[model samples]
Target: MTTARTLAVPAPAPDAAVKYFGAELGFEVDPDDLVRDLEAGRTDGYAVVETRAPEAFARARIPGAINLPYRDLTPESTAHLDKTLVYVCYCESTQCNAATKGALKLAELGFQVKRLSGGITAWIAAGYPTEGDKAPGIRCAC
Candidate 1:
């Protein structure tokens, strides 16, 4: 009589979920990296896309970032954008999912995209500068 063989699957390591997810589909950028990229002029091939409303954008946003609210994304609206350039999407804060939604839409449209991990709140908390009528120049010394 022949015995049937069974395959055994190993269990995931403890506290490896976050890392596994990050590694499987990495698309998050921290505030420091964003700032560093901007300072190095390496952001020429990227676009910091604010995925919030116009009012929110007008109130305050990343320097040189363009407004493209998640709710308003459309084929026509994004038609003029450069597909070759990577798009960095951010919303209000870590609690907000607008940036994720926007990134998904952009990805579906065949555009490379990444989501700002903690969004604008983290950026401001990191002492980064915001641009708007109320906010002037760079808030950071560097």
Candidate 2:
């Protein structure tokens, strides 16, 4: 009687599921939502941050993203950034952890941050336009 969908593993209680998903939303942003906000010019409260190296950023990146490689994240380096803005951090794709690292670093530095779910790969896959020479199909060499 046990099918794969109804195996020993069960779903969380509805309340737990709600809390978990709500918390997840607090820490992540969908590519489509971000693009929609960008198109509507509703980006006043946040900043898109590309966490790749300078070369990778130059290759291709979200149109208005500021490059801030995760490795270089430090208080002094991030001092000029506005503390009031939420930094949406992302890198190549799900294959890269730079976004998570960058988000954590920014948080540690007393900044608000969120990870761009699926990173640049998802953004491009969603048909959003990027800015750079290798846009639209830039693969992660990292």
Candidate 3:
């Protein structure tokens, strides 16, 4: 009998799994959940941030997302953001890391932060609305 590689490591205990999954939920928000919140106008406690270049953001982005490129996330630039609201950061897609970088910067700066799971790719794939010069549902080249 051969042990499958998938079972090389046993799964965590149910209690530990619960804690692990629950903690992951706190760090990421699904695109569908975000759209539901936006559609319902329940976004007062959180702000969407696009962690891409200004040109990329202008080409296509979440309807209410503020462009704050990860490379430019600084105390001076982020001062205008509301500290009370959790900032949800996203980049081109799961293929990109700008969102993670931005989230880390925000957290280091003492602000609440979460990453938009799968980023804009998942958002468009879900048929969520976006505002930009490009048409909605258009895949980003990135």
Candidate 4:
């Protein structure tokens, strides 16, 4: 019998992380890029979808983003949507997986999908505008 040998592997660099689009998960849109597209109306048949709950969406959402909570997505519900448009799904923040779930659902329904990197929180942090009645309004702490 031949002796078995083991090989040691070194860890990746501290900075080695998926900064932009992740290859394994396909394309991902950075917050700035998405904002540019939205501002310039250069979507090119792309749809930015908010995958969070209605309440979250109603409170605030990226300008022009349509609300389509992940839990309510289905063939029937999505029938009216253009299948050719690339669907970019986003949720609360990087910590939220709702966007990923929405992307997968859209992809299954034959729509090209890209997850929005960093989600809505990142968008707000980037100083992009949001649309909705419940969006942050004038506040006073007198």
Find the 10 residues in a row with the least total lDDT in model 1: 133-142
What's each prediction's TM-score?
Answer: 0.78, 0.93, 0.92, 0.77
Model 2 spans with C-alpha error above 4 angstroms:
3-6, 135-142
Put down candidate 1 lDDT per residue, 9-111, tens digits, no spaces.
Answer: 5557767877887774568888999999887788777899998778778877899899888877889999999999999999888778888888998998889
**Cand. 4 Cα-lDDT:** 0.79
Off by over 4 Å in 4: 1-26, 134-142
> How does candidate 4 fare on TM-score?
0.77
Best by lDDT: 2
Comparing 2 with 3 on lDDT, the higher-scoring candidate is 2
Clashing pairs in 3: none
Sort the predicted structures by lDDT, highest score first: 2, 3, 1, 4
In TM-score terms, candidate 1 sits at 0.78
lDDT of 2 by residue, 35-123 (tens): 99999999999999999888888888999999999999998999999999999999999988999999999999999999999998888
What's model 2's TM-score?
0.93
lDDT of 1 at 56: 78
Give Cα-based local distance difference scores for all models: 0.82, 0.91, 0.88, 0.79
By summed lDDT, the worst window of 10 consecutive residues in model 3 runs over 133-142
Per-residue error (Å), model 4, residue 7: 15
Error of 1 at 119 (Å): 0.6
List clashing residue pairs in candidate 4. none
